[model samples]
Target: MAASMSVTFLDVGQGDATLVSADGHHVLIDGGQARDDAIVPLRRKGIQQLDLVVATHAHADHIGGLISVLEDKPVDTLWYNGDEHTTQTFEAFLDAALDSAARYVEPTRGRTKALGGLEVTALHPGGDTQGGHLHDRNIVVRVSQGACSAVITGDIETDGEHDILRSSIEVDADVLELGHHGSRTSTGQRWLEAVDPDYVVAQYSEGNHYGHPHGEVLERVERAGAEMLGTGAHGTIRMRCSGGEWQARTEAQGPVVAGDREAEAAPGAPAEEPPATEAEVGCIDLNEASPEALEQIVHIGSVRAEAIIDGRPWSSVSELDVIHGLGPARVGDIEEQGEACVR
Candidate 1:
């Protein structure tokens, strides 16, 4: 059989840059900052041409480097939410796409494309929905090669995850790129009960101004018994799903597994589900983060903030990062707002 697709979580600091390679084809999901630095990583992956590009949303951290990619190389199809967000950043992104003759496909439910071993479908952003909730309106992609499959959630927040769960679609997968930097807002309890990913990751910057991988959010991921690999601490997380076995490059403090977790018999989580909102959030809390937490939050995306708050108790006033969204910079900003705790 031919080779399987591999997913690489590029170390773009607090931003996101993922490359999916299958059967010698390339698919990029959210590039890094505007410096065009992600190209080196793509070259390392042996990417000759980009067959597909998925822009989760118009956030600069995700779309900035895309300018570089387009300027430097040729890409076939670009999948993105086409709403006129109108920010200078968003406009620049639009201008870049128009500069190229590549097709711009609006992200919608059931939009499917196949390139060699990679088969990807848009499973979220259904019609008859409000478009303003951009984070929740983020696209969710289902990709598979041979016996292994992965789902990429683009900045999808609690509302989006819960909505997908209530739908009649399927959320089964070997690996899941956590939405929104693991901000407690995106991965709500029901969302976890639904995805149940075997391997998970959060793409954030090291010593980021924001304390990412919220303590409670990390606990939630651990509670699901998923193997979590983060870019901030683990470097670039790489995973290959083939022949029902999964292998990943990790920097875990403990032992690591090189294959997929056997949750095979479990029902594929519901995908075409309805949306739900959050009860509380982590950014609202300030005491939980460590000193390393302060820098990462400056460019924290909105996806994870949606689920940052679960129905859990703050062990003490110290776990400030448990609240939704406020990572390092926000906490500092919050203190500037006269809420800095005696940490």
Candidate 2:
């Protein structure tokens, strides 16, 4: 019999969590908030030991419930983006991970891990990448089994999306979990075009405070002509692939046609404001950003971050060449990344 892979998107309220299993191997990505039930699916499926567990980033909504998973389950390995948060939830998660016997790994772009019939590839957070807003530093991974693939994005916004593309990662997939819970800040037209998924899943609460699955994002998904599924509307989502064919089924219903889930706006209410794209947002302003924020840009670490801060009010991205350790070649890399700006 041919191998089969199953990807389950848990209904973790306004957060992200996914379970992928194939040939007796299981990988859980981004457990939801502390209040959510991220463990129910594991128990329901009789999965006792996880081969791999990934915390895409350190946000409470993304890694909060993972604390319990590490504490209770037998996880062989744990991969995090190395982004840290000061929240109690993050501290607890770190503690649990330290206490567990799982081998810890900080995945960077281009790293791939294989277990059983599945291949997991990290697509974001480049090797020199560090210290930015949590969303920009999100760890995006693409899970593949045979010919089928799914890209799992954890609250990654537009800049992060562009970084993945700029890094030349292959993102085309059969399934895509929408970024930032389908907010306008993510799922840009270019990103949608790059991934070109057959099915897209949005993981957010029905009446979330953030009003996820924004009208613009819905329109983009509709325009791309991909089937749309939501944990809020569909409960839990599961997709299976075997013999190179992929199919999606949700807890409430099967796959939904793209145009069916349009966002409703109040009469005369203005549309949700769109977020700045890579071009529009320009880049991390060298003069304004603190050392920590400057460190988020590729090729710039704590030392360079401080140097740039000390040389305040720079004129252009080209001026970065003057900073110590950043030669013409490194400056070109920063320009190619499109992540740093002077103004």
Candidate 3:
């Protein structure tokens, strides 16, 4: 029987943290900001030691909490990008890494390492990537266990994604940690096509200053036909794979088994088919549709439905951009879905 692999996307609030466990070995990736207490999840999971700890980049949001993790946990190896930063957080992380007993290795493109039952590979930041924007030089890692794999990108923008794509390393995976927290600057159309992940996770805080998980990114992910999960919305999300199959569970939506995403039929919609899951369902009149009907649209949820209702008498689908979080691209998705109409 093949062993099960579990990947937990921690809700670190406006930052990123993920833990991968397989065959009783654990790997920690890119602890969130210093105040996020990213180690708490580790403690909750009863993990006393980590087989490998990775610093995906020098950004504080990605490496700050790692200082504490390195100091407190017993780690066998540390993999980090060689990029240098002057922030106190980066210096503190360096001091902690040096102080720890773990061996340090500077990761390069196409370097693969073994940690228990998982094959961890570096897929970004080649030799030529030196001395560019930090986001462009971010280190990207892919973790594979059997036929199931996941790519965790740490704030890599389009340039970094292009670098990885240009390298042509096999990046197809079951899950993808959306780059740059789902910023429009990352997760380009070409990148999404290459990955073709079943699930794409965006790790950030709700109402964050940068408005992460941008609407354009959301539209693209929808267009790509991949389910999108967000830490800001679902809290901590855990994905498990066994026998070459994957399932996900989230704190907000318990027991989200594979191929069983929530589907609802709007009022007056046909009962035999759900508009949310069907390809050709009747569109709800946005001006006259109830909250429940409005919720059937691609991005409109309960809150957004209420907002749409309160801001009544829409002129066109493009007018949805006036509502918060409903950017032009996302509104376009709703229009493209043909689920919400102004009439």
Task: Report backbone clashes per prediction.
Answer: 52, 0, 1
Deviation in Å, model 3, residue 295 alpha carbon? 41
lDDT of 3 by residue, 1-343 (tens): 5656778898888888999877567888899996445786665444678988988889899999898899889999999877788999999999999999998988888888886568999998787786567786788999998887999998998878888899989899989999998899999999999999888889988878887888888888878877778888766777777767776766565445544446211111233422132122234678876554465466776689889988988888889999999998888777677646664
Off by over 4 Å in 2: 254-343
Tell me which of candidates 1 and 3 scores higher on lDDT. 3
Residue runs of model 3 more than 4 Å from their true location after superposition: 263-343
| Candidate no. 2 TM-score | 0.74
Which digits, one per residue and each the tens of the lDDT, describe model 2 over residues 37-72? 677556544457899999998888899889888988
Off by over 4 Å in 1: 251-343
Error of 1 at 48 (Å): 2.2
Q: Per-residue lDDT of 6-100 in model 1, one digit per residue for the tens?
A: 77778787888888876556789889875564886554333456888888887888888887677666889999877668677777778888897
Candidate that beats the other on TM-score, 2 or 3, i.e. the better one: 3
**What lDDT would each prediction earn against the true structure?**
0.66, 0.79, 0.79
Candidate no. 1 TM-score: 0.72
TM-score of each: 0.72, 0.74, 0.75
